[model samples]
Target: MNPRLKHLVVALSLSLLAAVFTPAHSADTKKADAAAVVQLQQRMDAAEKHYRDAMLAEDEDAAATATTSALAEMKAVVDACTKQRGCAVDTMLTTYERLLKATPQFDDGMPAADEDPLDERDFTAANVPDTANAASLLSEDGQRFVKMVQFNPAVQAGIRRWLTDMRPSLMDSYENYRYMQAQMAPAFKQHGLPEALLFGIMAKESNGKVHVGSRAGAVGPLQFMPATGRRFGLGNDGSGFDTRYDPKASADAAAQYLSERMAQLNNSIELSLAGYNGGEGRALRVFRDTGGRSFWDPDVYNQFPAETKDYVPMVIAAAWLFLHPKEYGIRWPSVSSRPSTITLAQPASLYELTICLGNWGSRDGYLRALRNLNPRWAADDMLPAGTSLNATFRISWLYRFNCAHGQRMALAKQLMASNVQSALVRVGEPTPAGSPQVAVATPAPSAAAAVPERKPAKPVKARHYKVKRGDTMSEIVRKFDCDLGDLAQANKLRKPRYALKPGQSLKLEGCKG
Candidate 1:
């Protein structure tokens, strides 16, 4: 063999080895590039998510500023990647551009430090409205109300108290007022009265709680006394239910009552409000004696008691806040006030409904709204199937989603069916020791044993008893030693709140007399 031929063979083998290893190394480099692209994409997604979360911050100005900064930082990262070799710059730049275009404009006005007292700390009884600067903080409209109400030191004090110490009560009133505005406000509007005046009176009277009753027999949202309520058709509605508890009825009565007072008091709103808080008779007598003087007139104001003096100013202050909350840096949370109706698909109470309809879009559940809208029904009353109820659109949506038929509905039903009586242990029962407690089944009495030998009582003819004023069925049953269930069944009386009327006759049952 020639020496040159041997050398050429070795050279060919070396060339083949180089060709094989070069392709393998190129494949590894491609895999590394693909992995780098995935890592870059993930980082971009995380940055976009951070920006979105920052946009939802409660402080509008801070949210806008943070979102803009986040977007700019993301853009810089894309530009840096674009200058690097083998980087997926085209895809990353496209994502960055899309995010920039979709970002909201940052034009929110800065909020004052004192504008959001609630956000400064968790809401507690201790940290309330700071009224030291209330006069300076008053909105233009609030100041106007002050002038109209004869801005005295007492009235200014009332405004400050409502703005700071009683702020939660004010917010609650606004929330409740939103639900009943459709029903109650129209009555005031028809009578040519400001709706804010109605809200103010209602807030002061009951904080928009429809079922509230004063110790003096004043009832409903407006706190009308029994006699005054009767004067305006707010007494019993003949269904064993009082119209004084009805928001719409009470609002109408309040409108009529206020209108009458204004007419009698020479159309002076202050005097009319005074007459509302005090007696109309006293208000008229004072106005007549003063010869049509202002309620703020020292002589005219001195005639009223301390309560009336405080009442007039407090109501005015509440009305002022209702008209101009934003001026005081108060932002009433937006509620879905669109009204809707819901017919119970089955027998369920307000309590059951509230449990099933979890708070999806609200801070608290919908029990208060339900009670306010349907004041006729008690919270625990099991409404008859097909009963119609007034509810908000959000509540209706939740009802359809959770209360219609699902685990939520089933759980709610199970909760409603629960009875403490069923779980009650005998008072004298002993606790089991060192063993799992077992339920014992009571033996059924034999048929013959169950049927007790009966002895008939001497016949005492049944008699009818006349129901006196303020007599409840239970009281009458106890007085006569009658079997309550038997007496109710005999008179066709309903259970749990048997309706009775004066001079109505009830036949005695299971009585010895």
Candidate 2:
């Protein structure tokens, strides 16, 4: 009986030990599974980081192709974990997705390319100024860096609305604003000027169109009436290089001039800008008469004149935009317009460069850039050699590589000789001009393309009339509120009847004082 009981107790004890050890083994297996998942995640994270870093490097284009590889690798990790381990790693996936979206987001929708071209290397380094000596070079060549900003929500929305109302052409106008700011702001700031001032000038001068000029002889981004431009050291470099129209150069002058006025006026940007637009002496005289009061003080401010009042507000508003682009709802461009100096030992015309654009497989982009980079070259001019282009761009390595060893010269030859008249071939279809089959062919008469010079914008003439009652004519003249025949005869109405309707309309074709 004792032997039977002892044997039973020993067997029960062994069974209990087996049960405990079995549960412990299962726990160890579960811990190992968790550890493996964590390890796989770490590996995936490392890969993601590598891709992320690569995306942030000296040349962003390198990441364009690598982007797909990184995405695939990440997806592989997620697939492996979800399928093999049944792991629910929502957080990891989100982090990876965000990295994918954010890596190449332009700085304020503009390239963060290093302003100090000398210091920049391949990828990962910020484009901020680094060296002390760069300032002298900056001053000499003049910095023409344009960084696009969100600006402010109000201004952006207003501009978008105004442009949308005008026409689709305004879409490019909006882009021009962004691009002009990018080209101008750097020089503006470098000279201790506010970026909004540029916007203000653009608003009054060209409505933000970079190519526009004033009939009063103002030209370029700021519409520097040629005399005023020369007074401010802005000139054509004696070769049709209208520096006033150069976003960088004009911005440089505008900033310096504005800064001087501001300092003279005791940091009053309003007064300073008023003087810049109207006349400094006039602004100062107005200030003196107002007992040196604040610009916003209605009593004296109103006396300054309507144009001044409107101008001051415009400057302030534009300045507000510079500081807060996103607030204005303005979406800046993804490209930077900072001036880059690539030495061309020889002069090269923009037209000649277009021909060599065959090297780039197309000249559309180069041709388009000419209006900004080399303003002197008419659209059709055979680029005379040795032209120093002030391109409104922070040219990347891609352009430099394309134009190595005077390759631009050959390109210029082609650009001059190539016909622009072939009715610009559709994109993706290579033009016969550059097609391998017809590479050496000369331009035919039909292919003779002329780069059209933008004609001076026609001035709009408005009619003035005095209110009159019951004045009707077979042809109603819209001036002086008189009979069409009487008014037309007064001016020189060529039309037998300058057809008119009854109302407050001009009674003559031309009303003179």
Candidate 3:
């Protein structure tokens, strides 16, 4: 061959060789990518199935375990993908999106021990687990739980978008969770109630909201209804402590109350839960009429109210989630074991502590720790000498002025008390809407009134509005910004939600009020 032709021929051969290898390498990459996609898809499906099972289960511990297992697997797949050089994690992302959109919503409103499941099963009044419920499999493993639940690409993306579009409070304060937990151990310990049990209770009771209250009059971190609370050592302490609002005191009371209920109800968590909500007298009465069988018996379980039936499972479900977060794919929460609260000899104010700490942030975590430790602190509490505080004391972090819990409590005894009353329920006296209100009178001259026989400043016309079926007088007043008391007076209606006939007319008097 000619020299030029030979060189060109060699170049052509080299180019051909490079082209031949390209497809082979591409095939290898594609095969790996395809496998990765399959794995991601499998993980997403598993996560969904596990979460559903956990939610319906009444055995929270079991549910939690299952949830943890589910998430652990999911995380393994994700971790592998993260390591892949040419990974198209988009499939994982897509799977997440598909599942989040496809799966049924778990909790749109706050969760509660008495809340009904999204779906019911073979469970019936006759067959429902006496206190059965559900939880997710992803809840078991901490890492998997976070990937599947908290940071699931699809669900989290959607959650982020939804939250951005409509502002709402989704994040929480550990203070509320801790307060609930602290209260649980002390109170239940006396009655042989397990400390771990508190996590489930607090999760369901208030979703960790300290200032929570139900329309039925339940209040505080534990959702103790006023009447029930008063009966169970939860209210009106001699020292001006409303036990319902006092974490330590209330927890102590709750433990005692739960123990009594459990024993009275034959040591059945299901039956005890029923008693907690449906009233002990009623639950027992129902059981008495029946064969007095176990809670899991459909016949025995059905004896309780709908709320009671639902309550048992929810508690168990929440507990399961706590124990096995992997099943639901929630984040691996590494909460330090809550420290024991040590009491001081004298009261110390939070403000004083903050000041004494020297340059603590107004909303710093340390201050939050103080509040969590002593939830009963009113704005003006004189954290009395011997007052208890929950803390993880570390002298190396910051010391000198701040002593160990014991010494600090002793010093606090000399400080003036705080103003706790000022810290009473932030949400108070719900205002009713859409009721008629009377306006303050701007009286015209008496002489002018006499001339026109007092054409009484547009003799406020009483307008007639139909009362919706669920309408409450308070609701009506709130809608209309009317005084509830005035609405009752004007309507001469005895009942606050005066059995409004659909065509009922609510008369607003004076100046078209």
Evaluate model 3: give its lDDT.
0.50
lDDT of 3 at 199: 48
What's the TM-score of each model vs. the native? Answer: 0.59, 0.45, 0.39
Clashes of each: 0, 57, 95
Question: Mind giving the per-residue lDDT tens digits that candidate 1 earns over 404-467?
Answer: 6667777876776554333534444663354344455666679888987888988966799999
lDDT tens readout by residue for model 2, 384-438: 3354554432332223434534355565555443333333454446667545433
Q: Model 3: runs farther than 4 Å from truth?
A: 1-183, 294-303, 327-332, 336-369, 379-513
Q: Residue by residue across 308-361, what tens digits does model 3's lDDT show?
A: 765565554444444443344433221222233444433455645654443221
Q: Residue 336 error for model 2, in Å?
A: 4.6
lDDT of 2 at 464: 52
Q: Model 2 off-target regions past 4 Å?
A: 1-174, 177-183, 207-210, 304-306, 336-368, 384-513
Model 3 residue 228 CA deviation in Å: 3.6
Residue pair clashes in candidate 1: none
